[model samples]
Target chain A: MDKVKLGKEQLKELKYFIYSRGFREPEVMMEILDHFACKVEDKLTENPLLSLQDAIKEAHKEFGYNGFYSIKASLDVFTRRRYKRIYWQEVKKILLSPINLLILLLIGLCVYHSMKWAYNNGFYDSYFNRNIVSSLIILIVVCTELIKFIMLPRNNGRSYHISIANTVNYGNFFLFWFFFPSRKLHSVNEILVISIIAVLCSVYYYITTLAHYKMIKAAHKDYDDFKVLVENENPLQ
Target chain B: MEQNQFVKGSLATIILKLLEDNGRMYGYEMTKAVKDITANRMNITEAALYPALHKMVADGVLSATTELVDGRVRKYYSLTKKGKKETANKISALRDALESVQLILTPKIANG
Candidate 1:
């Protein structure tokens, strides 16, 4: 049996079929497309009498009822968990670094003593004002990350779901302000509690920003690999 | 086709061994190679293979390079330095395990 090849239009249609089957990531889409195409061609070549469409259908059936969809689901879960694990590892390393260790020490001392100083100055009500700044900072950081993630060109990488999930989860922030508007501080102790929270928020923001940057870099690397792969396959381009 | 859990247990070594022998191979190529080598007795599903490849890639045991082949982006995976060393270790370990299993499977007379 001679080798049978798919046309450009057929390739596009094959891509659509993969996409419609629930593979949104171009990284996953490309891999599955190659696998599906190869199996279909192999089927056609062996049978010799089967049409291209029939071979494709037969190949899809071979993937079983779940097919690439289950692979996509498994991939999503694995990548998300992997990103989180990487983020936590980096966070641990960052906190253990000499500079960050010192910074955290300073942040702890400063937040505690600052609250005491404000209380000594008769600024008990100022905790609300301090919290407002922290709240707004959180909102701005969330919005900035959301915009960055949204502005990313479509189909960047396989594992960016964690970063995007971070932004999506920020929707809870609005409900927070809506429900906690009356949360007030009446003492230096209360102010100290808020300060600890504020400091933790900042630390979280720092780590997320780092993770997002790493993800973007990863996305670029994977997408670039894919682009080169596509370009290499079609020398006519 | 349903697969033997034994195959799943040895997937990493199998993959590393393949890459070591073949230089580099894409996802489907690896699956077809296994099937062809086993005369279709072994089949690795897409679900099993891709995640394993990604895991190896994530772990820095395998390095993936992509290239276009017939308008398809094929990700070819090859062993890294770490992967090469691990492959040797796994091969030895698998050999020992197989020997033990072989002894278990071999028949002997029931009476002493």
Candidate 2:
């Protein structure tokens, strides 16, 4: 068969090989194969000793399948490293940002003042005041904001999703704090409802974190596979 | 080997040069061309390749078109006017670096 005329079976095999090895771009893979075939055909016309299959095998040997994968892997590393570097740079900028720092300080002062006011008003001692609940609500909001600030630098698909879920969780916690009757909540039924909401929030946080962790793990695996391919293909060249 | 390290930094220059010569190329074709030209000495990673291409597109250094080929969508990248100018600048920069390095390494002898 003509080297230029790559059969469907060969194309399919090449595609599957690339995909199974974790190359995500199908178009790029096809283009590469087509280019390779063309080059081989050109080389064959000049020197007939280089059969199409032989040319392909030689080409493949020159650019080992694993080596190609490694390049992909190294690129992943480069991206992640670049992302991380950019993220930290952004974080440093955010930390140094006067407006952001001022907002955080203002919020901190407001919470502190509110806690002091609650104490002065004897809300902590009285059952009807709900000062403890309000304080808890403020604490949750502050922590949620802090979590968001920390996650902002690392923000990508997984981090973005996590931040959203955290926001929702905080919102639910706020609702439960304001609406749930603390005055009549000495009963078991009230306590059960509060406990369930708490449990639900805890579960949500666990699940979200777990999901993010799993995603990062998968990315790391793909990265490692890519690295292996590069090392195999270009061994100290 | 140190020259190999410069490959990453010079990738944009290399891509621009190739496009200058070839007029246009898709992602895989560009990569294959680089590999062939380098005689497989340098392997361009797909992950690095796409992001760089995308960034160049975003930066207006290159223009892209998506076309259906063999029942799949392929994105072709071609140099814009900005890309051509930038390529010229890169070539000049490379030439200057080569000259400077050669000047520094060349042995100076007393005039006879």
Q: Which predicted model would earn the best TM-score?
A: 1
lDDT of 2 by residue, A1-237 (tens): 443444545445545544554554532343344434444455566567765556556555645446355444443443445334433444455557787557545545554455445444445426444556454654664676577447633322322333333223334445545543454344445555554454444334433333343444444444444334332222112
Tens digits of lDDT, candidate 1, B25-99: 988889999999999998887777877888888788998876667877667899999999999999999999999
Off by over 4 Å in 1: A20-25, A96-110, A124-159, A166-201, A220-237, B1-3, B109-112
Against the true structure, what is each candidate's TM-score? Answer: 0.76, 0.45
TM-score per candidate for chain A alone: 0.68, 0.41
Score chain B of candidate 2 by TM-score.
Answer: 0.85
lDDT of 1 by residue, A160-234 (tens): 444456343345344334432334456766766666665565555555555555555555564565565564322
What TM-score number comes out for model 2? 0.45
Q: Which parts of model 2 have CA positions greater than 4 angstroms off?
A: A1-10, A20-59, A74-116, A122-237, B1-10, B20-23, B31-67, B72-75, B78-86, B102-112
Best by DockQ: 1
How much lDDT does each candidate structure score?
A: 0.69, 0.55
